[model samples]
Target: MDALTAEEADPVADEHGAHQRGGGPGRRPSDAQAVVPPGALSPAERDRSWSRLGDEDFDVVVIGGGVTGAGVALDAATRGLRVALVEARDLASGTSSRSSKLFHGGLRYLEQLEFGLVREALRERELMLTRLAPHLVKPVSFLYPLSHRVWERPYTAAGLLLYDTMGGARSVPGQKHLTRAGALRLFPALRRDALIGGIRYYDAQSDDARHTMTLARTAAQYGAVVRTSTQVTGFVREADRVAGVHVRDVESGAETSVTANVVINCAGVWTDELQRLSGSRGRFRVEASKGVHIVVPRDRIVAESGLILRTEKSVLFVIPWRNHWIIGTTDTEWNLDLAHPAATRADIDYILEHVNSVLATPLTHDDIEGVYAGLRPLLAGESEDTSKLSREHAVARPAPGLIAIAGGKYTTYRVMAADAVDAAAADLPNRIPASITDKVPLLGADGYHALVNQADQLAARHGLHPYRVRHLLDRYGSLVHQVLAEAADDPELLKPVPGSPDYLQVEIVYAASHEGALHLEDVLTRRTRISIEYPHRGVESAEAAARLMGRVLGWDDETAREEVRVYVARVEAERDSQTEPDDQTADARRAAAPEARPRLEATA
Candidate 1:
């Protein structure tokens, strides 16, 4: 079917009706009245959220949908505050989606004597693994190769010992020393001369995009008005004090004003731009540092555990992604477009050279499946080196009733959010409760362990393999049933996407029906890793995924075709950009690609 029948569309109206019943001016829809999942950010919910944003007065209005902004919304809502979060693009469409995907304590930061920052991040990491998002975040082992035989082992071991103890890590195993033979046995892909020995240590990894989206959804469950494709144009100020914001819908090109007691800016790399728009002096300047990562097939590298190597500039990680290996990250200053950070040929070559130096069978350009680049919002420092800039975030009241927060690592987003909300509390009329997000498990986190244990039975019931069920369980946790339930009417939905076998068609439908996926790029790149995991970079599966999404979003055949066309163009543009030698040329090539949300670039 091209579209969902009336019966299927009934749930969409019911979801909106449920919100209308209690989600009045300052109130939220209670769980008892919600016919749909409370966390569902469907297109219907997006409209409702926008309507509420235009009509109601909020205690806090968050500008940005990245991890920190989503975190702020969750922190505020959980503390009994009426909140609204508006994003220019889809959630985690920025730096949040394009991270190293590691929840580490920043082992390099220790050398810089950032002990407090390391401790804070490690604590947050432990929380994610144990209490917060065990389904999405799990223990990942990394082999830190010791090049020098003598002092390196003791030195690295000491740092790791501090790392293990600082966070009160209990769920994951601690560091273990290994001989050169043992290290080689663990990862046969590595060159024997690459290391004298290795120290294996436990850290955490997650789908950063999914985790950030889940954060926004969890906030929605708590009655936060979370809406994407809404761009902030200017501040709504009453004389000197900031009262709210004037926003424009990127999809419709409609303008509206949202009134709030406090407007928290979590714009990340665009912090200065937003500040300029608000006509306020920013407390601290933000410097954009571009980090690029390359993906290759799992078979390219023979490893049981991930590998961490020291580069001349910074540390390079060979992360073990499911069915693939994720190796990256070149840290260089980016002065071009913030919306689309492009990776140059030099960045890719730099990564390949560093990683290939140790790999027994060096990876070639043809082996690369995908390449992505993201900009980190660093607190600008006196040092010329972007790597030297601190990841520690700063919150400032640049103007009355306005607060801006920027510069922090992904691992410590919760803490950064709590601080932002704490700052917003001062501007709020009523006293708010302290942030309880540390205790609040994100949606799908509650019964994740139980679902993991029941994976085999679920597979049997669904007439699928045990591994498939386990994969769904990891991706959706207790909500795996909901994802599978979409395939009820059409059993074909249970099958994999045409070229992207890793993800099922039902996932594309569910992404639009439940998660807030407004565009094909959002689903291909952020909601699922098809764009990065597959060699085709989602182009092969775009049409099928778009049609599936159209069935849920009520798109016509032409619109679905347009989505496919834009997505293919995007992949091509990225490929073209990667061939460029420098940032300026790459930026032009990448920026030339047609946007999924065309109005976003036009309006911004």
Candidate 2:
């Protein structure tokens, strides 16, 4: 079964004269030549993208490409507004990709008495599981350890009962109480003395980066002009109101002014920065909170179910991620580089000390395969304590034609996006409908369930094992067929990439073609799990991955080697930084490597 050739892969034109297969516009002269094929972006296509932005005046311009920004673009475009979304980097390059990978109702939020947030998140979780992205979000169980014997069960059960009543509880099983012996049966990795009993509750998980990227792609299909490597330099103001923005194409260093009726700032941690750029007095400030997580091999932990335990400062999770266990997540206030937040030795030690207290066999630094640190953009309040700061989001229009949204959990990104778009519409000339994204499914979501049912046939057709095909389907949804077509001419693409055991060569090629992976690091760290799954953090596999990417990205030998060197240094610096005692020291060590080319530079 060979992959589809270029000519065979072109999308058919429908009666409306739109290319039904590719993601682009329709019914316009410019739309006819703007079609982009899956699995790669051509230089001509890139140039056309910039030209289209200049040729048309968008009704709304969305800044940022995280989940929230992607959601805003989708909402605005579907509402019949001419929209454009600009990202300084690739989609989900920040906190969106660095989350614990959960699509949960946040049972812990219940403890904070954030009933509204929990209920809203649960409803969104259900929507993702059943309608929006059944392929991306799935149910997973968590074991909550009960240290105290008698009072634990009743107290936990009461909370679980409330959680079940929240919207979309039917998507997963109800919570179950387990005695000490029973709990041990499910998680023998825990020491006998660690807990008296446990309560198992259901929640959901997802591939956050992939889900976010799909949101942007789906918005593009709906007529939103979406481009990465485009930086919002400043706001375009007309007297007292912000009319649009001045943007620079990072790839070509070309500057252009985009005129829109309204502008939405969904920059996440950089929310306040964008506000400052506009010279607008923002209603609220954004504080960066650092969270770090470590990935270790699954064989080191003998747990059938993921574990959620209470720590002195925050909760800890030992999650099952493919062939590894994802652990840690220290939350502390940070005022450092927003691009890369490094984890210190004390941070890692805090997690190991707490988790090892429960594990029968403890883990050490050498056991870690991957380390990632991300900054959460929390809305600033009067409180000096970062943990007590609000997780609820805010939508503010300090200046006319500009809307800024910040401070929300990953699970509630849709609500944040909808609100941002709704606010932007208030400044538009025409009456815009309320957001319909709640019922909207992302790209590849419509036929996901049906494809899952025919995984066997799909696997055989692609010359892949049934399990392998199932994995791809789960990740790509109905897009799996498109990816498999890439390798139709070369059967060997079906085989796994030599150094990266979890991914196939074809997937890497597909990442360059369809997923907007412009650089080697993008492919390794975000497009796939190679960065976190391998012991060397993709250093060993960098050359092979780079070669595969070069074929698509047109990288010369010198450029390929430079990319590999930069990636290797980044991993080394990250490993070295983790040994430091605090944020200041860790950041200094991490900064030893050459800085990643600015997001604008990569796209240019």
- Give per-model TM-scores: 0.93, 0.92
Name the Cα RMSD for model 2: 4.7
C-alpha lDDT of all candidate models, in order: 0.87, 0.81
Q: For model 2, how does the per-residue alpha-carbon lDDT over 1-604 read when each residue is reduced to its tens digit? A: 3433443443432121332222222122432344445322333345556887777788999999999999999898878889888988778889999999998887778888888888888889889888999988999889999998677788889889989879766888899989899999999999999999899988899988888888887777677777888888888889999998999876567899999999998999998789888998788889999988899999999989999989888699999888899996889999887877899988888889889999999999899888898889888743333222234888887788988888898898888888787777669999988889988887778767877888888787777888998889888887776688667666777889878877888888778766777777888888887888899788888998888777666778898898898889998998889889989989899878874454353221
Q: What's the lDDT for candidate 1?
A: 0.87
Cα deviation of 451 in candidate 2 (Å)?
Answer: 1.7
Candidate 2 similarity to native, TM-score: 0.92
> Which candidate achieves the best lDDT against the true structure?
1
Residue 287, candidate 1: how far off, in angstroms? 1.1
